[model samples]
Target: MNKLILSAAALALMAGAATADTVRMGTEGAYPPYNFIDDDGEVAGFEREVGDELCARAELTCEWVTNEWDTIIPNLVSGNYDTIIAGMSITDERDEVIDFTQNYYPPTASAYATLTEGADMMGGVIAAQTSTIQAGYVAETGATLVEFATLDDTIAAVKNGEVDGVFADKDALVPFVEEQGFMFAGDDVPLGGGIGLGVRESDTELKDKFNAAIDSMKADGSLNALLVKYFGDETAQY
Candidate 1:
């Protein structure tokens, strides 16, 4: 009789907690095609679209919140937001601090953008956004790593010759390479598992809901359509 009572109570708690509150989707609104602040000063990008759909699928009310990339995780942990839907790659190092849902974006490569060809990739001074995987990789490559608060600063460092190269996501570098004539230096370095929604470790129920939504999108092919829509035809799909 006691065991039956406890189980029923647990189930009741779970039911009541479903969609408990409005989930705040946190992101760095500077990474284009992922998340960005548009001309109207509102969050507008692939992540905004995906996040809204996920909330609908999960039956949760949601809101958008933008934060600086360097402080995004800390603010999430501090309850400034409920989830990190930014284009954040999952890694073992970060997983220690917070929990991640199943990957939404596929694994991609980090590349070096230099003004000239044949720039020394391994030993050259490189600029990368602070607190990023690219910054960590640059520090490990026997190169002097210059950290910047934003991606634009890294690209500017490259143009002004403050650094020999700037290392970042290949998708992000594509525009500069095509328009500004920055050439890729050295081989592309594959890093991280993939991109995922991040939530506090204690928010397992919230995580599960998002995981289910991602699975649904992947199963129905809507996720791949979004990828191609924002990242172009050649981008890796679900």
Candidate 2:
């Protein structure tokens, strides 16, 4: 009889917890390693793993939503989702629009890739995905900047001779270089202050929960494990 009472109480508590909070995790499912829709049509990758773990640690229910990169922040502000678990960098400009949790991914390098060695990175035409840090960096290089709607399109431009090179995250370009005969051109240009979860400015309580979860992951070494699992040890330096 005592066991039955305890079981009933456990069930009631679980039900109540389930009804507590369900933060929507928004991401650009196009970005590989960071977040992507796997062959199973479910969100998978580093961010997905980390985000789900954070939710678990915080004891908060969560769901995933995919959005385009360009309009992601706008949609977040408009309440299309509760949090952005995308590989978005924490910047002062962005911080003005929406608050950010402590960084989950350390700052990584942006690099240029081209089919030809010693390609003119100075005044040559370069392709960059719109609204990315790479795009802005390329613009400052005195190179003609060609904007693409997607990362794949930017790479395609490089192969098609429409652009002299493509600028993007170095790790994201690894597969392309191996498969497409492209070589890393010039030095790796460092950009962004590191990636973090974006939350609405009004959602201070939600941000606190996520920050606590992030802290726990860091303390337990789970965050570093996830980063190294996707990226290499160099990026896992936290």
Candidate 3:
């Protein structure tokens, strides 16, 4: 009887271990304030904290991994990652490819310019990464769009006069130019969208859990607290 009872307990322990929830989250660590690496080689940013909170709420373990922004979606689809927690904007175009949790961050677009003067460059030559929402804006506004592989290169093009302006996530670009003394042309251009957590199409259960967690965080003001921690109180409006 003792031997049989021991076997049953061992089997139960194994099943519990196998069912433990784990959420593998991907992010573009290059985007500071949103997702970035710290001096100690730890992933530290608003998104990272938010991911941790969500995992706790859902009773899961989160694994953070840095991925190139452009390849994030592909990696999720290929099962290289379970979800994307980067500062990814939700758009009709992207909805066709993967599922998204309810918006965790509001999306806003802005332009950075070297001249800081007259010229509606929103319709002129603008630098952006290919297949990004910024690139879509370039297409819609008929801007002569310059596509680059990285944000640094695109920002460099703006500083070098290769492009009239560069459009990107307002949160990501504003603090950067302010620190670097690069001039911004206009007020915060409202893209009037929202950032979402991306999940594979087959992972609807995980997506639902994340959405619930986000809602709970928003209600408890934890989301706003994180925003202020990273972007300052006034700039945390989004």
Write down the TM-score for model 3: 0.85
TM-scores for all predictions: 0.90, 0.89, 0.85
Tens-digit per-residue lDDT, 97-191, candidate 1: 99999999999998999997888878889999999999999999889999998889999999899999999999889888888989998888999
Q: What is the C-alpha local distance difference test score of each model? A: 0.92, 0.90, 0.80
Sort the predicted structures by TM-score, highest score first: 1, 2, 3
What lDDT score is found at residue 206 in candidate 1? 93
- Candidate 3 lDDT trough over 10 residues, lowest sum: 107-116
Which residue pairs come into collision in candidate 3? none
> lDDT per residue, candidate 2, 168-224, as tens digits?
999889878887799998889888888999999999999999999999999989888
Find the candidate with the highest TM-score and give its number: 1
What is the lDDT ranking, best to worst? 1, 2, 3
Which lDDT value does model 3 have at 115? 47
Better of 2 and 3 by lDDT: 2
Give the runs in model 2 whose Cα sits over 4 Å from its true position. Answer: 1-20
Q: Which predicted model would earn the best lDDT?
A: 1
